[model samples]
Each structure stands twice: as structure tokens, then as C-alpha cells.
Target: MRNWLKIVIFLSICLPLSGTADEKSGDHSKYVRHVEQGFSAIFRGDNQTAISEFETALAIEPDHSEILHYLGMAYAQEQFWNKAADSYQRSLALMPDNIEALYSLGVVYFKLDKWADAVPVLEQVVELSPHHARGQEMLGKTLLKLRRYGDAAPALMEALTLKPQAAGTYQELGTAYLNLKEYTKAIENFQKALAFGPGRYAEPHYGLGMAYLRLGDREKSRAEMQIYQQLQKEFAEYERLARLTRAEPNNLEAWSGLASLLMSQKNYPEAVQVFQRCIELAPNNANFHHGLSRTFMALNYPKHAAEAAEKAVQLMPDQSILYNTLGSAYAMQGKRREALVTFQKAIELDSEQPYYHLNVSKLYQSFGNQKLAQEHYRAYEHLLSEQKAKQK
Candidate 1:
């Protein structure tokens, strides 16, 4: 929670079964003797013997549900889920409706991602043994996995009511809310989840970032993204920083962002340098060249402006926007023919656009091509009329 890391997700599935050592050496009586000895040892601070003795007893009396349950418990104690599951299942087969065996089997199934299998068994256990925390938790988790969020919500809510400090319950509720796209609610629950501890949990911060971005708070969104980036930098060895620097030269954002920022600052030379760096870095980046061309125009460096504009045209020839940018750059450079050609290119890119026609008419008027000027002026007025009609 301190780091905004939500929760550590344990693998709820695939619980491994523990096995006993020195199993079944003598007769069934000897095995029973070892089992008794094992329980005595369990109480006497020797868990290894207890586990060993329990398995030895099971070997002697394979059908003894009581011994089977004990063996399963020994395996469960060691966190060996498969052996525990087998013993628990055998116990239930021998003595059906036994609540302990039912619960243990549910636990085994839950470990095995037998979620549907886990649900009914846990449901049955809860019905018989109401007010059981383990059953409720397991059922809630299984339901959560099945994406029955609405159904899972109440079960987890009940779990939190009983055990308010259970961190996993809050996390599950967060996941349910995330599934429902109730992002604000999800963020709240994820915050609650983080109260448990901090351990490689990135889900919450990312989710929060997305929510903030969706809510149109760019500052908050950026803050969360920064947090995520910081955490990612701390824990992971990534290679994006170099790539970003290479892409932007010296940028707090992409080329477009850097260009805009520098333009605002009126640091035309440094900004021009940045834009040119962008062009050098990404030779084929249409926007990069376009931005550099604009910066050169601002600096009154018409040669660089014309070069950058031509590069932008080469990169994205069909873009009417770039065509306009190039036309403007050419006009600034006193290349009347080049400017007129570029404006014509803009018109071809989008013939109904009045701006390109207006530019062309202005260019022709300056060049003393009165007939062409008049014709383009008429075209511009016609385009303006059509635009107004569309608006109406």
C-alpha cells in the first residue's frame, strides 16, 4: 500500500501434495502402532514422524476413513495438496456427508483449478456448516475466477464482514469491480487491498491510471503513469529509456510535444535544434520533418525549411496537411513555382478544401497570373459556399 502495489496473488490452483517417509515396513498392527506413535510424536514436537506414521497407518488400513483423514491432514500440513486430496476423497467415499472430508476435498479441487468442482462442494459445506471462514473464502475465490462478479461480490462482502483484515477479500472485490468497469470502485478496493503489504503488485496502479485517463484528468493520469514507470524501472530491466531518448533527442514527450513546448517558450533556435534532431533521428518520420520545417520557418531559415518540408512530403506524400505546410515553407523561400505546385498538391489531396484554393489564388495573384488567380479565387468562394451549406 505504501508503494501503491495492491496485492500479492498466490496461485490458488495446483496445490502440490506432500508425501510421508519410511512408509509401511511391518504388519498392519505394526502400521497401526506407528500411526499411534506418529500422533504421539506430533504432540511431542516431531512432525516428520507424525507424517511418516500417518502414512504407515494408511498403508495398513487403506479403507479406514479415520486414518485416511489423518493421512490427508498430515499431507495438508506439509502443503502437499495432491496426496491430501486423494486421502480426503477416499475418506469421503468411505464416510459420505462427513463435513471435514467435504471441506478438504473442496480445498483440493480449489487447488486444482477445479473451480466448478470446488464451488458445489464448498456450497454444500457452507449449507451444513454455516459461519465457516475457509468455506466462504474458497467459494468466493472460485466464483471470482469464474467471472461471476455479481455473484462473487456478496460472498466476498460477507467474508470481509467476518474477517475485515483479510487482504485477499479486498483484492477479489477489486477484481470484481474491475470486471464490471466500475473503475472508481475498483480503485477504492485496490487501495484497500494494498493495506496488506507491498510485493510486486502492479495491477492496481495501472488500473488506476486507466481510470484517471478515462475520467479526463491528464495530470492524475500522468502521475499514475509516472508511478507505474518508476516501479517498473525499480523491479524490471527494460530498454525503453534509450529508445525514447533516441526517438525524441531531448524530450519530455514525443517530437510533436517537444515542438509545441519549445514553440510556446519562443526558444526558436533550441526548438529548431530539437526538431532537426528529431528529423535526423527518424529520417522517415513525416511529423518529425513537418515539425522541423515549421521550426525552421519560425527561425526564418528558409533553406532548412524547404529541405525539411520536402522530406515531409517524401515521407507522407498524400497528406493534405503536410502539403499545406510544404506550400507555406516554399512560399517563404520565394520559390513561387514550387509553392504553387505544393498548393496544387494540397488541392489534389482534398479538392473541396477552400484553404488550399485560397493559397493558390494568392500565389497566382502575386505572380501576376490574373486569369489563374481569378479562376482559383472563384474556386475558393465556391468551396466556402459548399462548406457553409454543409454547416447549415
Candidate 2:
């Protein structure tokens, strides 16, 4: 399942407005100002500022459903689940059919692991908005947590229909089938999940392995189990790194390790956040900026990558790797001349770096300079061979 917090944050930001305070009311100007400020804070990820602004808004009009809902979102962002739930409950009390409030409340419950409490709220969400895919998905996950396998299967199946490529839902549905002793269906759903997520999802492989074991297919089960175990090891390492960062928020090494692991997992969004946090702790750290640049590149935000890479280069102008990263970002933005110049600077700084030579070679190739391309390519090959030989 997707992290409940992430789901709540996304929904809070994207869901259509249920309603707003009456602009024609006497206190409308004051209320709107505070509400606007609250939303601005929310967008900036300043939960404290958001909470304060929303409280001010509520003081003006305590019965406003929309402001209460916004307050819930701010509280949820800060992981203050109890406060979030209270705000959502208040919002729903004023506007009973507020689907977003209902869903957010259910998500808060799910995050709190109050699975039974989550069920009816999520059930109401799906009932009110039958086409709400995330609502169905959350309801199914809540049911799965409660071990209501038969109920979970249908809800998850509906979610899969709405979101055909949700690998997590497929994995959960496979689990439902597995526990129901429908081994073939379990294997089928798990295989579909693996096909969609490949190496990123381990749980499906474990489910598949269990299904195969039930069917007495030892070889297939062994292969799936091996993959599952390997992925589990990698996931364990990631979790350990994540825990270290949480335990020592000011520890540069811990944050760096977690950011690197997130990048390797291709989770560029979270990696960007981690890199930003690292930068916050050590603003002058060029490596954090370089990592942020790489993450932005992975996210296909070439302009952002260029900006971060430029910061990295400014902080550590002598580093060949920073120049290389800047060059790559420029190349992504179609700044061919800038890319070539930056790449050449990288080579000048460290002539023996084979990857730098390879980057220049590719750029030259793109510019139809075959002679220079081949020259740089030959240098890359020779340097790479020398490095390998030295290692051997």
C-alpha cells in the first residue's frame, strides 16, 4: 500500500473544494485572509504556520467546514493524527457529505492503525463517491489489515479496475487470494504485480513463492523466494538507513546514506526531500547539492537539476564530478554549447576520469563531430581499461 501520509497529503492538496466560507458574510475579509495564508503555508510545507493561520481563521468562524478540513490537512502533514482526526470530524459534522473529509479521516485512522475505525469511514467514502479509486483501495487495505480477506478481495479488485497499474493493490489482492486458499489466483495477481513493479516490490514475490509452494512447485517457489529474500535484504538496509536519519536528524552521514539509498531505489521525490534536509543541516555541503541535482535529473526536472548542479559547482569549483553533473543537466536542457564547455572543463580538471571522457564523446557524437567523438571515446576506453587493470 502507498504510505497513508503521502496519500493524505496528496488528496488534501488535489481534492476539489467542498465549499468555502461565505464571502458575503460580515467577517468574510478577515476569514478569507487567514484561510488564504493557511493554504499558502500548506503549499510551502510550513505546518506550524498553517496550523496557526487556520486557527485564526477558525476563531473568526468556528463552524466553517472548509477551514476545519484545511486544518485537518495541516495537522496530518505534521503527523498529528489525533488532531487531524478531530478537525476532520468537526468538518464532517458541519458538512456530513464532505467526501474529502471522510476520506482524510479514514486515512488518519488507518495511519493510527485503528483498522476497524477506518473501515466505516472509508466505506462511507466509497459509498458517497463510488468511483473514488483511492477510497476503495484504502478501504480494501483497512479490511486486509483487519483480516477480512473475503471483503478485501472485492474492494481491491474494484480499485484495480479503476487504477489498472497499481502494483500495491495487486499485491494486496494476491494476499487476499492466498489466504482464501485460491492459490492460482494468488499466483496470477502476484505475477501481475511483479510484471508491473519488477525489482521494486518484494512482497509480491514472497506471495508468489508462497502460492507456488502451496501448489508443490518447488523450483518456481525457490526462485521466487530467492528473489524475495534478496529484495528483503535491500529493503532492510534502506529501513536501517532511514531509521538512522530519523534518530540523528543532524547527522550528515546518516542523511547522506538515506538520500543515496533513496536515489538508488529510483525514489527521486523522497530522495530530493532527503537531500534538501541534508542541505538544511549543512548548507555549504556541495555533495548534498550534487545529490539533489542527480535526483532532479532522475525526476526529469532539467532546469532544477541545472540550478542544483550550478550550486554544487559554485561550492566546489575544483570538483570534476560537479562539473560533469552540471554538463549533464545542461545537455538535458538542450544547451549543447554550454554542455560541451562544461564537459570540457570536467575533462581538464580530471583527464583520467573515463566517464567524463565518455560524456564528452556522446556530446561530440550528438553534434556530428565524429573525429573528436572517436578521439574522446578512445581515451575513455583506454582509461577504463587501465583502471580495471590496476584494480585487478
- Give the whole-model CA lDDT for all candidates, comma-separated: 0.78, 0.93
Superposed Cα deviation of residue 226, candidate 1 (Å): 4.7
Task: Give the Cα-based TM-score of candidate 2 against the true structure.
Answer: 0.67
> Candidate 2 on 1-392: residue-level lDDT in tens?
56998999888876643333343464778888999999999899899999999999898879999889999998999999999999999999999999999999999999999999999999999999999999999999999999999999999999999999988899999999999999999999998898887557899989999999999999999999999898898899999988888888798888888888888788889999999999999999999999999999999999999999999999999999999999999999999899999999999999999999999999999999999999999999999999999999
Report residue 184 deviation for candidate 1 (angstroms).
2.7
Residue ranges of candidate 2 with Cα displaced over 4 Å: 1-135, 194-199, 219-223, 226-240, 243-247, 277-286, 301-319, 385-392
TM-score, every prediction: 0.46, 0.67
Candidate 1 residue-wise lDDT, 252-294, digit = tens = 3555555565666565776776777676666788987888888
Q: Which ten contiguous residues of candidate 1 have the minimum total lDDT?
A: 11-20
